[model samples]
Each structure stands twice: as C-alpha cells, then as structure tokens.
Target: MTPSIAGACGTRLIAQVLIAATVFSGTAARAQESVQTFPVAPSYPAAMPASPLGASVSALLDHARTTNPAFAAQRAETAAARERIESAGALPDPNFQVELMDFTNTMRGGGTTLLPGQVGETRYRIIQPLPGWGKRELQSRAAGAKADQAAAGLDAAWLDLATEIKNAWLRYYTADREAALARESLALLGGLEEAMLARYRQGLAPQQAVLRAQRELTSQRLAQVGIEQRRRGAAAALNGLLARAPDAPLATPADPAALPAALELPALVARARARNPALTADERGIEAARLERERTWADRYPDFSMGLTNNRPRGESQSWDLMFEVMIPLQQSARRAREREAEHMLAAADARRDATGSRLAGEIGAAYANFTSGQETQRLIRSTLLPQARATRDATRAAFETGRADFDAVLEAERQLVDTRMALLQAEVESRMALFELEKLVGDAL
Candidate 1:
C-alpha cells in the first residue's frame, strides 16, 4: 500500500479504539452506579431536635446495663448455678439411731428401765452414705455446665437489652422528627392559605384554593397531635428499659450508631457464629445435656454406706460394732427409661444448636439487606428527590401567585416535598435500626 493509504488506515484504527474506550467507560460507570453500596454509615441528620431529653441514647444504654433488674437477676441465676455445683457432688447426710435391745427382758422384771445401764442392752448407731461410683463427678460436671449456660445466657441478655434501647430510641426519634416536620408543613400551609385568601379577595384566585389550604393546615395540626402522643409513649418505653419510672423524662435521641465499614454478609455471619450469645448458649446447652445424660447413666451403679454401733449390757462392759451397706440397683426398666429421656434431651440440645446457627445466617442476611436498602433510600432522597421536590413546590407556588398555574398544582407540589422529607426521615431511622440489629445478632459491634 502507499504511505498515504497506510497513514489513513492508522488514523481510522486509533479513532475506532477511542470510540470503544468511551463506550466501555460509560458502561463501567453505569455498572458502578447499579451496585453502589455504603461502606460506612451516612451522617446523622444535620438538624437536631429542639426539645432536649435528659440523657443521650448511649447514656441510657449504659444505665440499663448497670441498673436493669433483668441483668441483675440473670447474674444471680449464674451465681446460684455455681453454688449448686458443690451440692450436686455432696454425699447424703449421715443417719443416727438409738435402739433398745432386749427390752422384753427389762420389762419382764415388772419395771421399765429408763437408763442405758438398767436395760439389758442399749445401742447407738451412725451411718454415712457414699454416692454411686462416678456419680459425684458427673453431677458436678453437669452443674458446671449449667453455670456455663447461664453465663452464655447473660451475654445474650446484653444483646437483647441493647437491641431494645436502640430500637426504642429510634422509635422516639422518628416520631419527634415526624411531629417537627408536620409543624413546619402546617406553618407553610398557613402562609399559603393567607396568600390564597388575599388573592381570592382580589379576584386573582378561586375561593376553593383558600379552602383547600385551610383544610390541609387543620389536618396537619391534628396529625401532629397523634405524632406527639406516640413520641411520648416511645420516651416512656425507653425510660422503662433504663430501669426508670415509666413517666420519667428521657432525652431526645441524637444520632444512630455508626454503621460498620465494608459491611459484608459473609463477615457478619462469621462473626455471629463465633460470638452470637444465643448460639453460644445453645452450645453450652449441648454440653450440659451431655453431662446430664452421663449423670443419669451413673445412676445405674450402687451407692455404699458404712455404719458403727456401740452396745452395752446392763452392768457390763460396752461393745463396739461396724457395719457396711450398699444400695442395690433394682428396677432395670425404670433406669433404662431415665437413660432414654436423657438421650432424647441431649439430641434436642444438639438439634437446637444447629437450628440456631441456621437462623443466625438468615437473620444476618435480612439485616444486611435492610441496612443497605435504607441507607441507599435516604441517600437518594437527600441527594436528589428531596431537592427536586422542593424546587417543584417553589416553582409551582410562584406560578400560582402570578395566576399562571392552579392552586391545586401548588398544593400537590408542596405535599410531594413533605412526603419526601418524611420518607427520608423514615429511611434514616430504618438504616440506623438495621445496623444496630445486625450488631445485636453478631453479639458485638461490627
């Protein structure tokens, strides 16, 4: 080919390559947008509540941890279990007896002898019992396992308490925000109503416009009353969690717990399996069950007892005697039935542990989904829809003032903006709750 022809071909090839690169870049950007996920939690609402409660959520959580009667009761249970370990391995209390032998001979003399020396024979005996072979150890081990299970349960209780406090705090925050947002809307509508009345008086707008504005304002005020009521109820619930009186005042919730970075389902599942209190308790239950089964089997063995007796004859020297006894393990059917019961219980414990693991995975999956969706929903509203709705309302109201648009159009736009704000608040609360729920399942902060 000629040099000119070759140069033209090279230029065409470079142009084609650039075109392909542009297409690929656009595709990559679209793909990234489709799969975008928040690695860290979004910022809390920039605006804080006007009414301040007495304490922050963090403080409330700490107070609940320290003062909640449930936790103290759980601790007491653990201590009680530990105390039982020694009792489980203890021997039966010794038995003591006093006997009058040859009482007929004494009575034959036509006189009842009250004294040991006057009787033909008198005896004193004591016996000490020993538990069956290996029974003490098994019993002690079972008790120890029970104590362990109690400890695990205590850990689970902590997660439960945290979940409750965080959830209640979120509920209060949602209601507070909703009430505040409604008030703002009421004020906005009131202004619009005044303006619409002025326009109606001037014959620039219809009377219906002013009437619609008044209705919306009244409806908003009524809704605010309910929202405030719910907020107060939420506060009461939170106070109860903190072990305070139900009517005790609580501070407004500030921000939600920060979300974990690079949240991954697999990682969360791993953490849950390793540390989830419920799962841990199940494992402890399995161990306790196994020990209990062993203890039941140990019951098939015989228990032994030893005794000593001192005998005295009237007007004679005393004699000492020793005796030993062992329990006969009779009733094979009863023993076997007990063993079967323990076996079934152990199997139940194993099944329970496995089921908990399965449920843990499912819970983490659900929480992860909720957390990601909520964050994305709020982010979209805050970044795009909220602003767009606000702009639409402003534009429509301006048009209505100029007699270029209908009053209903302005009302519709205003309603849309209010809904968007409400939705944003709901999403924020949802995201916060989901993140905390995830942590509760994992038994620790992610």
Candidate 2:
C-alpha cells in the first residue's frame, strides 16, 4: 500500500512539472509573436519633420551671419586689425646693458710711473629710441584707418550673407510651392484618367482618349517628381551655403504677405547710396590707400636712434669720455621707388573706388526695378488673373457635368487655373527676393 502511495505521488509531481513547462513554452511563443520586426529601409517621411509655413527673415539672417565662412573670416580679420592699432601706437622698450673693463699690465708698466692704470672699470648704459614729431600720430592714424577698413569689410560681409540667405530662402520656398502645384496637377490628371476610362467602358469614348489621359497623367507624375527633386536639390544647395548638413530637411515657407506701400524710387536710391556697406568699404579703402601712400613717404625718413657711449680710462689720470651718435637717412634709391609705388597705388585705389561706386549704383537700380516689377506682377495676378482662372475652372467643371462642355475643355481650364496660382506664388517669391537684394545693398532700413 505504501509503495502504491509512493508511485502515485511521483506521478503527480511529473504531471505538475509538465504543466509548468507547457505554460512557459506557450508564454514564450506568445511574446515572440507579439514583437514586431521592421525592414532595413530608408524612409523619406521618417527623415522629414513637420515644418509649418512662414519662417522668420530675421532668423535666417542670424543664421547666415553665424554660419557663413566669409563672414566669420572677415569678423576675425577685423578683430586682428583692431589689435594691430594698439601695437602700432606702442613705443619700443628701452634697452639696458652692462660692461666691465679690465687691463693686463707687464712688470715694467706696473713699476713705471709713466702711466698709472686703475685696473678695471664697470659701466651701465641705457639706449632709448625717440620717434620724430608726429610720427607716432601718423602711425596710429594709419593703423586706425586699416582697422576701420576691416570693420567696413565685416559689415559688407554681413550684408552679403543676409542677402544671399534671403534669396536662397525665397528660391527654396518657390520650389516647394511649385512641387505642391505639380502634385495638384497630378491629382487633376488622375481624375481625368478615371473619367476617360469610364467613358471608354461605356463605349462613349475611343481608346485614344484613354491613352491620351494616361499619357497626361504620366507626364504630370513625371513633372511632380522633377519638381520634388529640384526642391530637394535647391534645399541642399542652400544648406551648403549656410554651412549646414546637406541632408537636413528644409521647411517650406508661406508666400510673402504684402508689399511695403509708398514705394518711392528716389528715396530707395538715396538710402542705398548712403547705407550700403560695399560703398562705404570702398570709400574706406580709398582713404586707407591714401594713408598708406603717405606712410611710405613718412617711413622713408629713417627712424632716429640716439646712443650715448661712456669711455672709462684704464689710468687714474685719464677722465671718462662721452660720445653721442645719430643715424641719418641714406638709402635714396629704395625710398624713391617705394614713394612712386605708393603714389601709383593711391591713384589705382581712387579709380577703383569710382568704378565700384558706379557699379553699385547700377545694381541698386536693377534690384529696385525688379522689386517694383515683381510687386506689380504679383498684385495683378492676385487681384485679377488668379480669381478669373479659378472662376473659369469652376464654370468649366459645372458646364462639363451638365453636358455643355467636354473633358478637354475642363482639363484646359484646370491647367490655366493651376498655372495662374503657381505664377502668383512665384511672383510673390521673386518680389521678396528682390526686396532682400535691395536691403542688402542699403545695409538696413531701420
């Protein structure tokens, strides 16, 4: 009986173990099934982040100033030039030296009373160089002018960077809007294709209509792809210019809202002439060159060095002697050559300044004209063409549904409408870019 009981208990233990093992295995399988496996594929949507329309112009300018290599380099140069101004005005440190004198005498000289020697004399001397009248002031002015020129260069760089960033941002937004328009066209084409297929099935249209619709859809699709590719390429290029990663996704901005009212050409020109950093920089260049030429001649007058020498006699009967020396300018050939070179350089600088001024004026005029033209064009498109085109598309669609028009007519109407909208968007973008260019030339409106 005890043996039977033992066998029964053993069987129960084995059953419990098997039950536990089955439950654990089932749970493991369930967990495995619950885990999801993803494929190793690059996803465009995953890489893209949500960016709303209309980024800030101020932010873009800030980014350009901070990131642009040319701007950074110019800023560094300006700082270095400022440091040079301090160095240029500083006086040379005084030099000090010590000398020891000793005499070796023979027995006959030591015993003889002809000349007695003190044996040795120690001396200390200091030499200081003093600049001539107005020399230090000239040097200081020249260095200050150079520093000012560098500062002007830095300002120009900042203006240029802001302008470039604005233009690139406009182009990027334009491409994005164009891509959106292309996608809308593709959708319209798809709808047309569906209509054409339906007509063919009903034996109301020929195979040619279906083929035509298919071809149009494919073309629209290709166009959408091309526009998207262009957008991406433009974004990458802008990012490169801004010193950002090429793969960083760009955010599309909304169309510029409105134009600045009371646009006066004369006022803009005057502002640009006065405020433009490029013109100011050129002006500073002319001054710097003139000063540089003066410095060449001024430096030709050799710097004066005064030295005082103390001579200590070996004999007690001899007194100490003092000698003073001065160095004179003697290299006439080198000085004349440098002077002539500086004069020629000054002339060249003046001529260059004039040429730059004329070019800057022309650029300002061109940018102003473009801005005004874009504003008018955008106004016309917005206030007239776009509305008319949209109304025409609606009418055509209604007429076609009522059998008063055909598919071809509706398609043409839709194309006109889409084109008009896109054209307006482009005009707005172009106007903003032109305004940016104008502002760059003018330095700042505020």
Candidate 3:
C-alpha cells in the first residue's frame, strides 16, 4: 500500500476507536446518573409511602387550617353569615304596654279612701309586627345566598393556603437539590484535583491542571454556600405556611417523584367551571343580589301589625279588644332607589363572574403549558442532554490523560454535565409546581 494511503487508514482507525469509546462512555455515564442518589443524612426520615410529598403537604395544610389565624377568621365569618339567615326570616318581637285611665279620687268631710279597687279603667295590650307578603321569604333567600358566598370564600381561602404551601415546598426542594448537586460536583472536582496533582508529581501533567481543578472546586463550594442560603430561606417560608417558627426544621422527600401525566385541557376547564371556589362565590353574589332586588320589590308593599287588648273599668265587666294596624310605604322614592341599587349590584356580580371565569381559564391554560413544557424539557435533559454531557466529560478526561486533549476541555465538559443536571432538577421542580397550580385552579386533584 502507498505510504499516504496507510497513514490515512491509520488515522481513520483511530477516529473509529475514539467514536466507539465515546458512545460506550455515554452509555456508562447514563447508567451511573440513573442510579445516583443525593446525599441524605442517616437520621433523616424516609419519605412518606403514598403520593409524592402527600403526607408532608397534608400535615402543613392541617396545621394552617387549625392554627393559622387567617383561616380561623374566615371560618368564623362563614358561621356568622349562616346565622344571619335565621334572623332574616324571623318575625319582629311582640310589644307589650299598660295604661291607666279615668281614675278619680273623691273626698267627703275630709275622709279619704285607702284603696279604690278598679277605680281606673286599666288597659293592657300586646302588638306583633308582621312583614309584608313574601318579604320575609325574599330576605331569607338573600341571606342564604350570602351564606353560600361566605362558604365559598372559606373554600377559596383553604385552596390559597394549600397552594402557598405547595409553592414553598417546591422551592425548598429545588434549592435542596441544587445544594446537593453542588456538593457532589465539588467532591468530584476534589477527586480530580488529587488526580491532577498526582499526575503533576509524576511529571505527566502540568501544574496548571491541578490549579485549574482547585479553582473549579472552590467555585463549586461557593455555589454550594449560595444554594444553602436559598434552601434555608425556602424552608423558612414553608415553615411560615405551617405557622411555625421561621427556623423550624423540615424534612422533604428525597426523591422528587415522576411527573404526572398530562390532563385534557377541556376536561380541566369543565371541572374548573363546576368547582372553582371564586367562581362559585361570584355566582352566589349574583343570586344574593337578585334576591335582594326581589326583597326590595316586596318592600314596596305595606307591613301589618296585629294587637290584643284587655281593659277593665271601675264597676264594669272585664273586656278584650282586638286591633289591626298597617304600615304605609309612603317613601316610594327610597324604595325605587333601593331597587335600582340592587339591580346594579346584580349586574355587577354577573360581570364579575364572567371576568373571574375568564381569568381562571387563562390561569389554567398557562399552568398547563408550563407543566407540559417542563415535562418535555425534563425528559430531554434526562434522556439526551445529560447523557451526552456526561459522555463528553468522560471522553475529555480520557483524552487529557492520554495527552490527546487539554485540561480546559475536560473542565468545560464537566461544567456542561453539572449544568445539565441542575437544569433537569429545575425543570422537575417547576413541572411539579405548575401541576400544583393547575390543580388549585381546577379546584381538584388531577
């Protein structure tokens, strides 16, 4: 064979070997990453067995509902609203009165009677005010609608609390993962530094490689410090949700469970329509306004009062009298004003309901999009980018050991791997958070 042809064949064979090695390294790195678990303290508790972070979330929510003053206040308001219904339907209390009339004192020859039995005509009366026809019923309906609105408000408060807790928890999880990854990368860089120093001592690698590795290790350590700070802040925020002291310790699940399957958007929107608490509250407001308008119309009629009287005159038989009274609704202008106010209020409630529904739909759409995109990105990173970065890192390290590549190339590859891993973690956390938000918007679990 010609010399030039042999040289070309040799070069091609080396290239093939490198390519094969690269592929093998990638496969190995992917296997390693799949089995890798973040560092956990021996005393740390195991994650709850059921749903992903379900136990922790439930405990937090229970604490907020039971101990949080805001939640308690909302519940109290709901109870008060419910009590008003009975008051709205009840009749006015009966009034009682007593009168003395036609009493006379007679004196003859400077003599006065000690007692004059039944000398005065005494009268006793009781009166009861009755609401106009259908007025009390209308009032009761309005009150009931208000109670429903209050109940919906309570539900909304609960949902908000739960969402807040979930968000804080997710943030903590992300920060924790970031810290763990930084620590792992630092440890890896430390090992590399030791290897580089050994190689330097043997005069095989330059002193600069050791210094570069040390610098990278220091950077990773600094990053870990920042991550720890973030993790602490996130934990404190979560503690606040649980109504605990800011520095209270919290245990998060070690494994961020897999992403949930995508839900149908139409189904979610429909469910939200039926179950969203804010929308329900707006609907109740509309009903209450309508009922109030009806009540105002009923108020245009006159109310009535009935009375019973007992009377006794001096030397006369006891007598009973019946009396009826009516209230004239003479203030037509005021009644019309009230009716107009109620009509406007009803229209305002309807407009608010429409706005709320639109806002909710938009929120659902955004959350769903975020979740879906995060899921896809996470999958891509885990299945492709992460493995590729790891493979490049391994290949670069091997090439550097063989004097075929520079230390800078190895460092860059390692950095890429770290970044890919962090991105995957972030995407996973974001996906989970988006799911929580979506569930909250839908008013039910997926």
Candidate 4:
C-alpha cells in the first residue's frame, strides 16, 4: 500500500476509535445514572430554607409524602411488586407422601406372615418440581422489570401529588391577592367618596357625584366579601391537600416562587424525555412485556419432578426407590395461544410507550408556551398597561377638580386601573403555576 493511503487509513481508524470511546462513555454514564438502590422513594428537603411560600410548600409536600393515603397505596403496590421478584424464580414446593401397603387384612406382604404389625410396608417419599431450563431466570427477570415499572409508578404518583399541591397553593394565592385588591379598591372608593362630598359642599361638584362614589364604595365592599369567600374556599382546598382539617389556618404566602431566569424549549424537551416518570414507567412496562413474552416461549419446554422414596417392610430389609416425572406439554393449542397473547401484549406495551412519549412532549411544549406567554403578558401589564391606567386615573381626577371632566370619568379610570392591576397579578400567578407544571413534567425543579 502507498504511504499516503496507509496514513489516511490510520487516521480513519483513529477517528473510529475516538467515536467509539465517546459513545461507550456516554452509555456508561447514562447506565450509572439509571442504576438506583432498590425500594427507591422520592426525596424531600430536610428543611425549608427558601421563601416563606416555598418553605410552606416544601413542608406540605413532605407531610403528604408520608401521610397521604393515595401515596401510601402506591408505595404499598411498589413494595408488593418488589417482593414478587423473590418468588418468581422459586421452585415449586416439595411434596411429602406416606403410604402404608397391605394395611387391609386381605393382602399379605412377600416373605412375611400375616400377623399384626409384621406384614405391612410403609413408604415415605419427597418430590420436588423444577421448571424448564431458563424458565425460572426469565420469570425472575420479568418480575424485576415489573418491580421497576411499579417504582416508576410510585415516582409518578409523587409527581402528581406535588403538582396538585402546587396548583392548590397557587389557587389560594390568587384568591388571597384578589381579596386584598378588593379591600384596597374599597378603601380607595371611600377616599373618593369623601373627596366628592367635600367638593359638593364647596359647590364644586354635584350631589350625584357623591351619591355615585358612595354607591361604588358599597359595591366594592360587597365584592370584597365575595372575594374573601372564594379565598376561604381555596384555603380549605389547600388544607385538604395537606391532610389537615378544612378550617386549619395556613401561614400567608408572602411571595410566589420565582420563575426560572431562562427556559430553552429544546433543552426542556430533552430533560422531559430523560426524566419523565410516566415515560420511564411505560418503558419499563415494555421491558417487562418483552421478558414475559420470552418466558412464555421458554414455557414451551417441559419441566421435571424427581421423587426419592424410602420403604420398610416389617421383618424385612429396607428398600429405596427413585422416580422421575416429566411434563408432556401436549396442549399445543394452549401454549400457542399463550405465546400469541404475550406477543400482542408486548406490541401493546410498545405502542403505549410511544404514545406516552408523544403526549409528554406535547405537554412540555404547551406548558412552556403558556409560561412564556404569561411572563410576557405580565411584563406588558406591569410596564405599560398598569402605569398607563394609573396615569389616566390621576389625569381624570385632576380634570374633574379643574371642572374639565365629570366625576364619572374619574371613577371609570379608577376601575380600569384596578382591573389592570388584578390582571397583572393573575398573570404572575398563572406564570408561576405554569412553571410548577413544567417542573412536574421534567421531574426536576427548574
């Protein structure tokens, strides 16, 4: 071979080696990450060290992890699945038999006289059944995979519980903010009522203006009551999630959890694919189905049972007997049906796994989109809409005092300002809720 050609070949071989090394290392790292100690449970922070809202949420989640009945049920199921692995590969229980021969008076044993306790033979046998070769191992592997699936299910259950708690907390947060805003609006209306009354007494405003302000103040107070009622209901729901009495008091959440500084859609999708518990569970289900299918194929082979017997004849020498039993597996139709059933189940599991992946991807996308939109809306309302509304309210009030605008215009501007502020608050809460949902989907805190 030419030197140049040999050099090029050598370089190509080096590149191939490097590529293989990189792939191998990546695979090894991923495998390590996937290997977890058995009976894995969700981890919670030992202490709440963040904001008050975050701390409260963390504490509630910890409480629910141990106290919630639903979580307990899923945990029990996972434990059961784990235990099944031990029995999956076990041999059938050994059988013991005791037989007395010639016990009736009509028969006599060979070379023995027909006398009481001297003519009968008694046998003791023990038999053990062994499964076909490789069957037990396959059964064990299938059970292990099922246990993994159940563990994933338990993880998913925790995620669901966390999501519900977050959603409930957000709801309560929103309601509480709404009630506060309503009370603030009521106070503002009372001040406006006083100002209008003074203007009417000084002959600068009409009696109708004072009456309109009073009417609005009354309505605002009523709205405050309604908002408070909703807030209480939300609080009760949140308490229920925490496994507390409905009337239990909760510490006011001073602030909502902050959104991530940056969220990349592609990165989020990749994380979800890697960490989503639902998808992981489905993947394990596929593995279990495949293993079960292989086990069914292995079941086509015959199993064996062996028996050892010891017999003693009265006034005669002891004898030993050995026996072997084989299963015929003659029901070809039934075996074939089982194989077909396993094949279909594996196919179904694969389809379900694929469907779960697609659904998770869509959910991640939707949550990210909602989160981004909410952030943008909140920014717009805060930077432009709210300031503009406040400015309009102030300008209208000035115009009314200068006899250039009606009191109605001031009241309308105030209402617009109040509505804009509430919208901004709602947007903020919605954005935070979206983040919580995204975290749940990704199976990690963002």
Better of 2 and 3 by TM-score: 3
lDDT per residue as tens, model 1, 156-233: 887788788768877877787677667666766766676666555545556677788788888888999999999989
Q: Report model 2's TM-score to 2 decimal places.
A: 0.76
* Order of the predicted models by TM-score, top scorer first: 4, 3, 1, 2
Candidate 3 off by > 4 Å: 1-55, 100-122, 312-318
| Tens digit per residue, CA lDDT, model 2, 184-248 | 56756666666556545545456887787788788888888888887788778778777888878
Ranking by lDDT: 4, 3, 1, 2
- Which residue pairs does candidate 3 place in steric collision? none
Clashing pairs in 2: 54-254
- Candidate 4's residue-wise lDDT over 113-183, tens digit each? 44444548778899999899999999999999999999999998889888888778767767776776676
For model 3, the local distance difference test gives: 0.75
> Which candidate number maximizes lDDT?
4
Residue 42 miss distance in model 4 (angstroms): 12
lDDT of 1 at 93: 92
| Every model's TM-score | 0.82, 0.76, 0.83, 0.85
Stretches off by above 4 angstroms in model 4 are: 1-46, 49-55, 109-119
Winner on lDDT (3 vs 4): 4
lDDT of 4: 0.75
Cα lDDT for residue 352, candidate 2: 80
